[model samples]
Structures are given as C-alpha cells and as structure tokens.
Target chain A: MLERVRIVLVNTSLPANIGAAARAMKTMGLAQMVLVAPKIFPSPEADTLSSGATDILAQARVVSSLDEAIAGCRLVIGTSARSRHIPWPLLNPRAAAAQAWAELPVGEVALVFGREDRGLTNDELHKCHYHVHIPTNPDFSSLNLAAAVQVLAYEMRMRSLEDDQVEAPFWGVDWDIDAAPAEDIERLFVHLEQVLVKVDFLDPENPRQLMTRLRRLFLRSRLDTVELNVLRGFLTAIEKSSKQ
Target chain B: MLERVRIVLVNTSLPANIGAAARAMKTMGLAQMVLVAPKIFPSPEADTLSSGATDILAQARVVSSLDEAIAGCRLVIGTSARSRHIPWPLLNPRAAAAQAWAELPVGEVALVFGREDRGLTNDELHKCHYHVHIPTNPDFSSLNLAAAVQVLAYEMRMRSLEDDQVEAPFWGVDWDIDAAPAEDIERLFVHLEQVLVKVDFLDPENPRQLMTRLRRLFLRSRLDTVELNVLRGFLTAIEKSSKQ
Candidate 1:
C-alpha cells in the first residue's frame, strides 16, 4: 500500500526540503518520491538533509508538471494547511488515508505537495480527488513541507497497520456484556447539562465556554455504547430524584 | 484540567526549544510551565522563539529536581521516544491526557520531558505513574523536544475543547457519574494473567514475549470495567474447563 502511494513535490524551491521530505517519507515506510520541477536536486544540501535516506532521492521521479506526475494515479490527494473557500471534500490526514486505502485501484496514488512560499494553486488542487488538511495551530500554521509529508505518511502507515487482520471479540449469550450505545451516551450529556443548569453550575447567559469544556471531557473518555447507556441511566435516576 | 497540567522540561539545553514549548502549551490552553535545572532561563533566544507566548514563560516555575516539580501531582506522565524495561503503563498522548484529566486530584499534574541527548533516566521515569510514548517513525525517532511537547499539548487542548459544555452534544448528563475504578481494572489484569499462565498461553519456564505483547495489546484497548469483567469471565471459564 505504501509502495502505491507517491509523494509528489511540485515546484519545490529548496533542495533541503526535498531531501527532508525523502527522509520523512522513508522514516514512515514510504519510499516513492516524485519531484516536479524542483529548483535544485542531486545537490549536496539535499543529500545532507536526507540523512540516511539517499535511496529515495536516487529513485525519485523528477517530472515537469503536476499532471504528468499524477497521470497514472487513481487516487489524488492535495496537502494543504489552510482551508479553501471552494470546498473540495476536505478530510483530515487520517480520514483521507483511510479513504484512499479503501478505494485504492490498480494505478498509483499521488499525494501532491506544493512549493514552500505558497501551497498548491486552486487549479492544481482541483485535479486532486480530495484535500487533506493537517490540523495545525491556527495562528502559526507554517508546517514545513517535510513535516507535512511526515504526518501524511505516518497516518497512512498507521491506517495500513489497522487493516491487518485482528479478531474482534465474540458477541453472544455466552459472554455477559453490559455496555451502553452511542445514542444513550449522547442523551446522558444532554441530561447532565440540564442538571448543571438547574443547579446554576452552568450560567445560562454565559454558558458557551463551560459547555464546550464539558463536551471535551466526555469526548476524551471515548465512551463505548454500553458505557454510554450506564451513564445515561445514572443521570436519569438523578434527574428523577431532583424532581422530588 | 488544563490548569492542573504542568509541562516540565528537565536539564533543557536549548533556549529556543523552551520558547517553542511555551508556544505549544499556550496554543493548547495549557499554562503551567516548569523548568527543571535548565542550562539557561529568561534568555533572549527563548523570548524570540516563544513568539507571543512570553506570558507562559513569565509565570514559569523553575525547579531543581523532577521529584520537587511533581511533588503534589497524583498522576505523573513521562514522555519518551524509546521503550524501557518495566514499562510504566504505556499510553499514547490522547489516552494519557484523558487518563490524567480524569484521575488527577486537585494538585499539579507533571508532564516531564527529558534532556535533548539522553532523555530521562530510568530513576526519573520511575516517579511517573505512566509513560507516554509518542509513536514516531521507529527508524528516526529524534523528534525535537518542543515538537513533541506541541503534539501532546495539542491533544490535551483538543480533548479539553470537547469537554466544553455549550457545544457538547450530550450536555444534559452529569459528568460525576460513577466510573468503574482503575484499581478494579488493574486487579482484573492480574486475574487474567494468572488464568493465561494456567492455560499455558503464558509459559513460566521459557516465556517468549507472549505476555508482554498481550499486555501491550490489552493496555492499548484501554479496557473499562465492563470489558474487563467480560474478559475475566472468559478466563474463568477456560480455567474451569481445564480443571474438568
């Protein structure tokens, strides 16, 4: 699966970034490198930055245009740090990799990275089937090109590992299971919020920040279906008692 | 919860990384910063690297030892890129943050990062209740300390955001609902291990890494009480069958 994915650096200016990209990709078990009109390649700076991953550079395909690089690819994803006004089915790196992995065809899958100064042009991005934005700090979203490649490659590798066969625990009368469903958990949160409001623990007028905090606390729990039900039942009992 | 978490850097050599760490923590809504035996402080380098997060550095606590920094912390999580013997209850960053947020008492929660070169000594790590190993590329796991801090801070902040009340989908439920105690899960692991040993799945004479792998797999699942009970029952049944 990693072999099928090619990292395409389009119009990259820095040879060091190109080398770093190779090193990052190689670190994450990705070897295919496509350099599209880089300012300098086969330079000492690139080789030095690549660390021990010179093999990736040696085998890299240097193309003239993004179209030529992704010509044979079945799945195309453009890496962008910023969101676009023209939404093109944006997926986070993890989801995008999952989607690409699930829908991979016979041809190569291209991950296009743009030049350092500016990201991919709208026209070039439009050629992609999906856009993947790595969640970064909103204020300073200047992720190095190599870092971006590293994140995508890492996510793809993790998704691939998850695809390997792992037996799910058996579910039946034989095993006594007591876990809540997702809906019940969602309901519990609603009930809890009301209780907080009733007790004045949650200020109704200035409630945005408090409520957001509460949501985060529960989401971190990643409460399974059964756990949700149990929590909801507890909340229901509490609400009933408070009515008295 | 974010208030309780103190990001501690021990024997930090670079002032720039310290500044970067401050920026990362601030972005993630984590305010507490502790510098343990740093080579330098209030350096212009740190100020420059901190960007707009100089306030975090202004309020930073300087300590002499890892122990003093985390004296009041009920839950101490140490970060390392490498694996160690007697693994201190390993967790990924998200899971560790969740656990720390849920379990920590009304005191400091230390997240100790080690020196740039050697990392935390085993003795220093022993003080932690759990070790958080960020899954980086195994071949080149040399992540900048500040970068590592950024990843952790981001996860903690993201989780904290979800806990906010107003935006929570399940805001009505009381978050104080009883959770199956952590001790119960720990005991269950012991019981399950005993059963595995009895069933020859875990061999005492020539243990070939089976138990370690099993422990890692189960620990990764982050099994709650209900899931633990289900596994325990299965193990009990296997034991009864063997006796018969």
Candidate 2:
C-alpha cells in the first residue's frame, strides 16, 4: 500500500517548501515524490531544508503538468484548503486515504498538493476524482505546504497500519468464535420479532416505530454470534415466563 | 483553554525556527511562548521569519531551565520523536490534548518541544507528566521544531473549539437527566456492593473473587445514575422475588 502512494506537488514556489514536503513525506513513510514545474528544483535551499530527507529529492520525478503527473495513477486526490465553485466529492484527509486505499489496485495512487501561494487552479483540481480538506481554524487556515503533506501522509500511514481482519477479545476468547454471521443475526431478529408480537410486548398493528427503535438499539450494540445467542436465550426465557 | 496553553521551546538553535514557531502558535490561537536556553534571542533572523507574528516573540518569556519554564503548569506535555527510559505516560497528540484539557487548570498548560538534532533528555522528559509523540515515519523522524509545535497547537485549538457543554450524545437523555454527580457515583458503588452481598451475588464466604469480577464489569460500563438506578431496581426485584 505504501509503495502505491505517489505524492505529487503542483507548481511549488519555494524550493525550501518542496524540500520540507519531501522531509515530511519521508517522516510519514511515504517516499514517492513527483514535482510539477517547481520554481527551483535541485537548489541548495531545498537540500538545506530537506535535512536528512535529501535522498527523497534525489530520487524524485519532475513533471510539467498535473495531467502528466497523475497519468498512470488509478486514484487521484487533490488537497485543498477551501471548497471550489465546481462540484467535486469532498473528503477529509482520513476519509480520502480510506477511499484511496480501497480503490487502489495494482496502479499508483496519486495524492496531489497545490502551489504555496494560490493552491491548484480549478482546471487542475477538476482532473482529480476527489478533493481532501484538512479541517482547520476558520480565522487562520494557512497551513504550510509541507505541513499539509505531513497530515495527509500521516493519516494514510496510520490507516495502512490497522489490521485488516476484524477480531476482538471477549470473555477471554476471540469474539470470532461461534459468531453468527450477518444473515444469522438478521434471521434471529425476525424470530425475536415474531415472539415479541405473540407475547404482545410488540403491537402487531402500528408496530413500525417501536420495532425501528428496538432495531437501532440492537444495531448500536454490534452483537456478534455469541452475544446474539445470549440475547436470544434471554428472550426465549422471557417468552416462556409470559406463557406461564 | 487556549489561554492556558504555554508553548515552550527547549534549546532551540535557530532564531528563524523560533519566529516560525511564534507564527504557528498565533495562527492556532495559542498566545504564551516560553524559551529555555535558546542560542540567540532578539536576533534579526527571528524577527524576519516571524512574518506578522513578531508581537508574539516580543511578549515571549525567556527562562533559564525547562523546570523553571514549566514550574507553574500542572499539565506538562513533552513532545519527542524518540521514546524515553523513565516510561512517562505516552500519548498521541489528540490524547495528550484531551488529558491537558481535562487536567490542567485555567492558568498554564505547558507544551514542551525539544532541540532540532537530539530531542529532550530522559530527565527532561521525566519532568513532563505526559509525553506526546507525533506519529511520524520511523525511518526518518526529523520533523522541524516549528512544524511539530504547529501540529500540536492546531489539534489543541480544534479540540477546544468543540462545544464544551455537549456530552457525547450517544450516552442519551438518561445520561443528561439522571446522571450521578461524581461524589454520588462513588457512594453508589459502595452501596451496590452491600446490596450484591444481600442478593448473594457476592459470596459472604470466599467473597473476593466474585466481588472482583463484578467490580470490574461495573467499572468497565462506567454506570451513570440512570444505569445505577436500573441495576439497583433489578436487584430489588430479585430480592422481592426471593422473599416471595
């Protein structure tokens, strides 16, 4: 996943900021940097600002345009401080990373950052499928170019590190055991509803509101198979007691 | 909350970075700046780099030691890339901000960032009650001192802006209505144990084991008054049933 991420800087003004961006990217485990018509590349100022991240700049790919920069990438995310006039699906940095991670196949995923002064032009922004906005103070939303890259890269790296398999510990056992699948849980809900109606705990007529509320409560609990069985057992006991 | 945050730079080498730090703080609504053993103060480079934030530097306090800088602050958060031997409570930026917001008084909340090369010494880290480690790439963790300050300041500002009175809504109306005062909650736990014994859920003989498990479960739930009332009511019902 890390290898697939390609960070592209578009028309960067300051060489120092470009260097800092590379440093930021490297710090967050992101190596691939593509500069689009930087004002001054391979400058001493850039090397000085990059500190230990000179290797990233040494290996960086230089391009002319945004289109040329992200040509091969399957997933393209444009970074923006403010919303544009044209409609584009907007996502926060974390959500954008999640979207990118989900969609990224064998192809590269390009995370495009705009210029230091006036961000990406609408034409450049239009080329990307989604725009990511870092939430900031309304009064002073001036995030440095490198800081912007750092935030996005950090989110992507953190998400990548999360375990793919969803397993939680419960009662000194992995909750995956005896876990009723989703279909089973849905079937049990139907069964419980039938029993509730028979017991008159749920009104058969005009039951929509009450049933919805009950469903929401159960959904919020996120019960696995063992927990579902425990709940069903309790409901069964209640049903028997009602009959008695 | 913003007023309470004191931004402390320890052994800062560059005057320009100090200026940048001031600008970053001001942008994030953090006012106080404390410098500890800086190489140069009142340097022209600092004023030049400060941009429009020179006022923050002008008002900044210079202290002889890190200890002196944070003497008044109850919550001291040290920022570092590396982990320390003393094992101060390690927190991510958000968690550290939450802890600071909750624990620190309205007077001073110290956020300490170390030198550019080697970060805070183990002894310096020990002085802080909590350590905030910005999630950076392990391979190259060389974040600019000012950038590090900016990230933490931004997080703190964003968190502080969230509606202070609004309890997380998931806890529901019962939480709002029948919520126990902190003192009442503590008392209720003691009373609950006494009732547990009467109900024989707590064994009169060989009591420690069952009581420990029950206590653990109750603590995990963090029962408010509404929850406490529900449990107590159920226990009363059981006692009545036993009597019958």
In the range A58-169, model 2's lDDT, one tens digit per residue, is 9999988876777666557788765666445667665777766664443467899998778888756655656778766565566778878877886787677656322221
Choose the strongest candidate by TM-score. Answer: 2
Number of backbone-clashing residue pairs for each candidate, in the order shown: 40, 2
Looking at model 2 chain A, which ten-residue stretch has the lowest summed lDDT? A165-174
lDDT of 2 at A81: 62
Cα shift from native, residue A234, model 2 (Å): 54
Models, CA RMSD each: 25.6, 32.6
Report the C-alpha lDDT of model 2 over B1-244, residue by residue, as the tens digit: 6867899999999998998888778767788999999999978899877666778899999999986888656457789665653344567776666666664433357899998888887657655655688877777788888888877886686567555322211222223443333334344556666777776777777665454445444533435567778877776676677642
> Where does candidate 1 stray beyond 4 Å?
A13-16, A42-51, A104-107, A163-244, B1-5, B19-32, B40-61, B101-108, B157-244
Q: In model 2, which regions exceed 4 Å deviation?
A: A104-107, A162-244, B104-107, B161-244
- CA lDDT, candidate 2, residue B88: 42
RMSD of candidate 2 to the true fold?
32.6
Interface CA RMSD of each prediction in angstroms: 19.5, 23.6
Tell me the tens digit of each residue's lDDT in model 1 across A1-244. 6778889999999898888788777766787899898998878988887877888899999888886787656557798755674555566666677766653443467889998889898767755656777666565565657767766776677677674423222121122342223234345667888888777688888875565555445543445456666777777777777743
